[model samples]
Structure formats: structure tokens, C-alpha cells
Target: MLGRVNHIAIAVPILEEAAAIYRDTLGAKVSEPQSLPKHGVTVIFVELPNTKIELLEPLDDASPIAAFLERNPSGGIHHICYETPDILSAAEKLSAAGARILGDGKPKIGAHGKPVLFLHPKDFNGTLIELEEV
Candidate 1:
């Protein structure tokens, strides 16, 4: 079962501009910029009382997030990462339940170097979902 919501990651063409909207208009304070060259995306965390919002933008065209933005031009919510106690078990259940996994069984290092896996949008009512251990 899906546990807590880890964070909502939004895909943007420009992380700074998107971050500004949360900081300027919404008044959500943001963290320092962090670039994950491995993932080819740069992320900025918007801190809130309850949860955080991660604004992610591609560093290059080869970035998977870049591909996601091109396919979904609206570019709002990219993925919902749910916190799980056991990532492997969670991913197994998802696969057994017929959810197509985008990244296979391996858990790649995600934000903060935590293990993460991706489930295709088709399996989640067209919403991309990620599983991460808390």
C-alpha cells in the first residue's frame, strides 16, 4: 500500500522561474539550488509547514524530465512520490498488480540520495508515481 506522500515534483523548463512563483506569489520559501547531473535535472525545494514542493527542470534535452515536459506541455505535476517503509516490497506489489514500471526493479538514487523507482502514468490514472523509502 502507498504510505505517506513524500513530495510532489513539478517538471518545469526553468527551475528558477518556477521556483520564483512559489517564493514570490505564494510566499513559499525555497532552498538552495541543487543540480543532479546524473539525473540531468536541477531541483529546488520549497519548504512548507507540512510538506515540501520540489521544482525540477531538465539540464539538457536528454533528461527524462525534459521528455516528460515535451509530451505533456501543460507541465504541472510531473510525479507524486509516496513514502514507503520498504521500497522493494512496494515496487513488487505494484508490479504484481499490473502497474507498468518505467525504471525496472532497480531503485536509482533520487533527491537526497534516497532510493526511488518510477511507475508509469498509465498505471496511476495517468499520473506518474514514484516510490521512495522514508
Candidate 2:
């Protein structure tokens, strides 16, 4: 079951600078950086009312966020993650219902140390869909 949107991830090239701006300038207190090695991103999260704002910085060329930043002149929203109680089951249901998943089958640990899986844009009608279990 999709519970709610946990966070909106924004991909950027300079995470530290962004963190400072959001914290000092914008007054959004952010969490400590957590490196998501699997996704090649170092993330910093800012808590909100019903959700959070996750700042994602690419660690290398292989990082998907790198390509995303390159494609868009202005870095922006990368994906919106919906929190699920059981990610595996949710993914299975989506697959059975014919939604295309990008990977081989299991949710990988995302920026928040949560199990996360992404539904293909082709299947999600251009808006990226993410399932997260924290």
C-alpha cells in the first residue's frame, strides 16, 4: 500500500553549498549527510510537515543523478518517493499489474537508508514513481 509521499528528492551537483543555503539562508534545518553507495549519491534531508526534502549529490559519473543534472540546465526535482509499509510486496503488485521496473527485482537502499525501488518513467507516464520503506 502506498502510504504517503515521504520526500521530494532534488538532485544537485553541489550538496554542501545547497545544504548551507537551505539551512542558513532558507532556514531549513537539514539532517547529516548519508552516503547511498548503491545509488552513488550523498544525501541530506530536511524534514517537513507530511514529508521531507532530500538533496541528492552525485558521487560519480555512474550516478544517475549526474546524467539528470547534465540533461537539465537547472537542477531540480529528481523524484518523489511514496512510503510503503512493504516495498517488496508493493513492487510485486505493480509488476503483476504490468508496471515496468527499472531493475532486476529488489529495492535498493536509497538516500535515507530505506529500501527503495523506482518504477520506469515509461510505465509511470513520464513522472518517476518511487516506492520507499523506511
Candidate 3:
């Protein structure tokens, strides 16, 4: 049901600073910031040979990432995304297996403009899992 690891997301207090670290200090190719209003985050992707690293900053106080930042203050790993060949089928299988899906239990358009669904962290060893249809 899962393909390769898509991208690991890191919630940050400031998007520009985080992107700078990856771009300047690490010498990574960071993509331009993209605002995802539906997800309530502004993200920038650090390109790598194998996988990408997503830096997320809360779009507003109501954003889930804002809550995460409040808890950590310094920010931290938010979620890990995995590629799935068929998100609907994967969601159905996960649901039948008793894994809870976040939100309305439906896929949303992700950063890559692909269908994505988030599973409960409790069901995945305290790590939020994002399934993105590849």
C-alpha cells in the first residue's frame, strides 16, 4: 500500500529562517515558499538526491502547526509522508484495519498537488503519517 518515503516535514516557528538554514548552511536547493491555505501552512521544500525535506510554518494561530510550535517552541519533526500508488484503496485498507484517518477521512490536495491523507499519530507509533498518492 505504501511506496517510497515521500518527504519528512518539520514544523518551524519561522519559515524564512528554516529555509535559510537548509539553503545557506546546508547548501541545499530549497524551493520557493508555497502557501497551502487549506493545510494552514506555508511550506518550502529542500531538494535532496533521495528525498525532500519540507519546512512548514503556520499560516495562522488556528493552524495545527501553530499548536505544534506552541508545544515545542523551537519546532520539530511534524510528520513523515509516504507515497502510495492508490490513496483511496490505501485509505480503505487502513480504515478496515482500524487506523483512524484525520479530518473528514478524505484525501486533500497536497504540496505536490496530489491526493493526500493523514493517519492518526497514535496508530503509527506517535508519528503522524501522510499518505500521498504517487
Candidate 4:
């Protein structure tokens, strides 16, 4: 049902600065910024040896990251993504187990162009969980 950790997403006020910090300060390989309108975020991935770190910025005022920034100001960890061999089955199992899925309870295209679904934070000890199809 669950695989390796996919990526850790961090919401930031500025995408470029966050990406630069990873690239220059941490000496990491960073990918180009991509706007995910459906998710209302512009993201850049810092490619690491074992996993990636996603830096996300709000695409608009209505973006969820914008709301997160309002509370955090400095921004913070947005979500942790985990790879899943079968998202639909995983969703079913999670649902049956009383875990609430966010949004319409359907998988959407993620940053890697894979099917992804988000679980509610309350169900996961205040941490938002993202399941991405492997």
C-alpha cells in the first residue's frame, strides 16, 4: 500500500530564494520551477541522492499556500509525500480504516505527473500526507 518517501514539500513565500538556498548553500541539484495551477502552487524540486525536497509558493491569493503563509508568515513544511503502488486501492483501504481523504477523494496529477491524493491532517497526527502512485 505504501512505498518509499517520495518528497517533502515546503511552502515558501519566495520560490527562487528557497531553491537557491538548496542549490547554493546545500550544494544540491535543483530543478526548474513549474507552475501547478490545479494545485495552486509553483514548485521547484531540490534533487537529493535519496529523495527530493519540493519548494512551493502560492500561485495566487486564493492558493492554499497563501493561507498557510498567512498563519506561518515564514512558511513551513506543507506535506510529506509517499509513494504507493496502487493509489486507488490504498485510498480504499485508508478510507475503510477511517482516514479521511482531502478534496473529492480522488487522485489528481501531481508534480511528477503521477496520480496523487492528500489525506487530512487530523487523521495523521497534524501532518498532511500525500500518496503518489508509483
lDDT of 1: 0.84
User: What would the per-residue lDDT of candidate 3 be over residues 1-134, giving only the tens digit for each residue?
Assistant: 97999999999999999999999999999999999898799999999999999999999999999999999999999999999999999989999999999999989887678999999999999999999999
Q: Write the per-residue lDDT of candidate 1 for residues 8-79, one digit (tens) a residue.
A: 998887788888898999999999889989989899999988778888988999998988899876567888
* RMSD in Å for all candidates: 1.5, 1.9, 1.2, 1.2
Off by over 4 Å in 1: 72-74
TM-score of each: 0.91, 0.86, 0.94, 0.94
Worst 10 residues of 3 by lDDT: 104-113
Give lDDT tens digits, candidate 2, residues 99-124: 98778867887656788899898877
What is model 4's C-alpha RMSD? 1.2
- Clash number by candidate, in order: 0, 0, 0, 0
- Ordered from best to worst lDDT, the candidate numbers read 3, 4, 2, 1
Local distance difference test scores for all models: 0.84, 0.85, 0.94, 0.92
lDDT of model number 4? 0.92
Q: Please give, for residues 1-134, the per-residue lDDT of candidate 4 as tens digits.
A: 87999999999999999998998998999999999998799999998889989999999999988999999988899999999999999989999998999989888887678999999999999999999998
Error of 1 at 73 (Å): 4.6
Q: What lDDT score is found at residue 53 in candidate 3?
A: 95
**Residue 26: error of model 1 in Å?**
0.9
lDDT of 3 at 32: 98
